[model samples]
Target: MDSEKELSGKTVLLMAIATGIIVANLNYIQPIEGLIADSFQVSKAAVGVVAMLTQLGYAFGLLFIVPLGDIFNRYHLIQIMLSLSILSLLLAFWAPSLIIFGVASLLVGITSVAPQIIIPYAAYLAPSLHRGKVLGNVLSGLLTGILLSRSVSGLLGSVLSWQYVYLIAAIACTILLGVLHLYLPRDPRQKQHMQYGKVMASLPKLLAKEKHLQGSAINGFCLFGVSNVLWSTLAFYLAHQYHFGSGVAGLLGLLGITGVLFASIIGQMVDKYSPRMTVGLGILFSTLSFVIFTSLGHLFIGLIVGIVLLDLGTQFGQVSNQAIVQSLSLQASSRNNSIFMFSYFLGGSLGTFFGTLAWSNFGWSGVCLVGTIFLVLALLGHLFLKEPEKLQKVS
Candidate 1:
């Protein structure tokens, strides 16, 4: 493969598909937590610990595993991670105790960093002229997978069993692994001799030196925190308020596809306008979504509209912030991404933990309150912090 070759639409599409399949593993447990709770004879709130552990595991991988993309063969690394994901999923499928399942879930989160690897790899391959557009297309697929995973897990869990969701995910990953082996391009520019310790050490230096990275990381943290606040507890909310099952909670995830549909357009907007503008809009949409969730949440239609706005806001913030992060240094793209996403998922983990805590204590009102606080923090950062001058020029 030519290191300087421009990415083809077909190759980008394949990467998008591969990203979607690999990333879906992280989310399969959300809607089905209730089913797993029933099987393990645990409270619904207790099962949330498993969800939090998974997000923390993903944060750990972002810090430790994803930087290997800068040093090793990304193509081979992706395959190895996918294979490990299959094993982790299988472990989740067969575990008889909640403790073992929680361990497997953590492993699942750790190995599922392939999408993060793929994103930076795609950025390296894409022309700078079209990088935002390309990333948007790929993210559309990624978000689609995330939204669909809950739906599929809920339906499968309701019809069969929660354990079967992992079994099926394992099978899906096995197939995706073969597909990637056949189709994914190898990066010829990888540094075979880069020291792991140095790569890891540069992370803090990057965080300290890059003003845009710092601002974007904080935005990503708070924005994703808002997202998880809703997702981590959505199943319980549906069950409590409407007497719905996991199936309906999963099906409601479909509503968020409205935002997914606009991902590419948002990417184009990033290319045309500025990341700062899009990010601000994202924060506004997210804030509005919570307002709806807080006030009109008693109505099912309110949930539908709030979901659409929330997802749209998330796409705006995530894609724009990622574009800024990737543009920082092509040589250190993976490490840059690792720094940004580590904070991103760390916030998600905390959001899941605090969101569940709020739900346990104050019900839906508490969940909305938690999400609103995160959004408000994100909004304040966006308003007060100016993008680095270099980042403005790059955009």
Candidate 2:
């Protein structure tokens, strides 16, 4: 495989599809928690544990597994991860107990870091001028999978057993693994010589040294936490307020396509302008979205409009932050991405925990209040944080 081979449109499209499929594994359980609870005769709070465990696993993978991309052949690494995903999905499909299913969910989450690898790989493949656009397109696939997986899961759960969802995903993963094995070129870069322990040691050093990386990680943490608060409890809110089931609740994701639509445009903006400027605009849009939801979430039309702004705003903020973070070091893009995502998903885990607690105690309003707090913190952090002129001295 020629590392110098220019990326084609077809290659980009394949990366996008592969990313979507891999990411969907992390989210396919979200909308169908009710179904799983019913099957296991458990409380909704207990079902929330499933999602929490999955997120925890993802964070762990980001910290531990993604750094390997900087050292090993990424193509082989992806194949290994996809194969693990298939095994985990099979376990999820056939688990005899909720405990078994929960464990499988964790494994699925761990292996689902394939997209994290793919995103940076795409960045490497693309020319520097088009890097933002390429990353945005790939991330659009990622976000679409995160949002739409809910709908697909809900529909599958409605039409068949919830277990069937995992079963089907296993089959899909198998096919994707084959496609990737055939289509992906061998990674051409020489493997890094850093020992694994040294690699792990550098994460904290990087965070302490790179002020921009620190700020972006914190921003990612808060914004993702806010987003998770909404997604984690959306189904329960709809079910309680509107007498809707998982299927109807899941349909809200379709409205969230506003994010997908704006991703490439946001990428172009990143290329033409500063990431900081785009991030500021995104924060304003997201903050306005919360204002709408807080005041008018009870109204169905209001929910739709709020979701559109919320999705668009979050994607704008997220993509720009990524563009900046990925620029820190070309050689360490994978490691840099890992640190950022580890923080990002760590926030997600916290949000899921508290979001479920909020749902149990105070319901929709509580969820909104908590989510608002996260976003406000993110906005303030971005405003106050200063990027250092040269991180090389500290590094």
Candidate 3:
């Protein structure tokens, strides 16, 4: 552990950028599915295997790997995981067939759990007053990476080759790996000496012990699921309803920059206000976004309006939710984060499934309704949780 307890701006910036770069690997294939399909002479839908496998791999790692942050030297774990991610990208870059690419993508997702470790580690380094603010900054970088990945991938696929994106990402990851190794401070907390099995077994206990964590995790799941419902089929909706190309569909990610900006501000708000209030405010925006999409999304302007609302609302809720969870147990921050993110992405997978079904059966209208239903459930779940009456006395 580093003797220094306070975080530096330079450290925060590196953490933020590293998180963004790591997470971008998961999204890089999304906008280039068509090019990948063309390369392998497969249907566009088949090319989705890379993205799906990557997500599944991430879920697996969250369940199995991220908890190690609680037990091992996190700095060592981070370096090992990031190096593995770089190798995965290299494999993906040279993949000759869809099958090999899918495998490599899965490895990339698994290794990308490095950021989950990084986030909690950052939380540990900050003062309680600024934890949310620091997390917000990191999440903004993550959001930028996710959004820009689609734009960059689309442009590269059009002008060069989709494989070039993976190659470039590999190079970027290598640079980030070296930087992180050279600069990141060691965790100040003493490492847990728990066995691997004990570490894995502790997750259920963590969930059972923390009602707030459960509430936040459930809320996160529903919110992320709602976002995925719209995102998974956005290109299809653009093509069918607006006669737009994939390039245009990719640009919708830029609308999410609104969310990125809000993430940092919302963190400050969470510290000044209550997490419950912030979450409620975010839910209002989410509900409004769905209402607009349902009634007026046929217009380009309406779709844009819906995109901004959804992204902003989701970020507000997410930042607040994460703040609440990270505050639960400092000793178990990584495990708590793992459970939270696992549920979050599981919700995403569910959303993708139901969104595909809704789009197939009822078109964009169904998508809107499904997303609304998710928000409603999330709101209700949040409402049912016991508010922290103690927090009222903090200030």
By TM-score, the best candidate is 1
What lDDT tens digits, residue by residue, belong to model 3 across residues 1-395?
33135578888888889888998888787666656777899865565545667777887888899999999999899999999999999999999988999899889888888989999888888777788888899888877888887777767776787898999999999999889889998766665778889878889999999888888888888888898778777766886887765677678878999988888898888878788888887788888988988888999999999989988888887888888888887788899999998887777767766776677678898888899889988988888974342222110
Per-residue CA lDDT of candidate 1, range 247-300, in tens? 998998888788788989998888887888899889999999999999999999
lDDT of each: 0.89, 0.84, 0.82
Off by over 4 Å in 3: 1-5, 48-50, 386-395
User: Can you give the lDDT of residue 376 in candidate 1?
Assistant: 83
The lDDT-based order of candidates, best leading, equals 1, 2, 3
Better of 1 and 3 by lDDT: 1
Ranked by TM-score, top first? 1, 2, 3
Error of 1 at 383 (Å): 2.3
TM-scores of the candidates in the order shown: 0.97, 0.95, 0.93
lDDT against true structure, model 1:
0.89
Candidate 2 vs candidate 3: the TM-score winner is 2
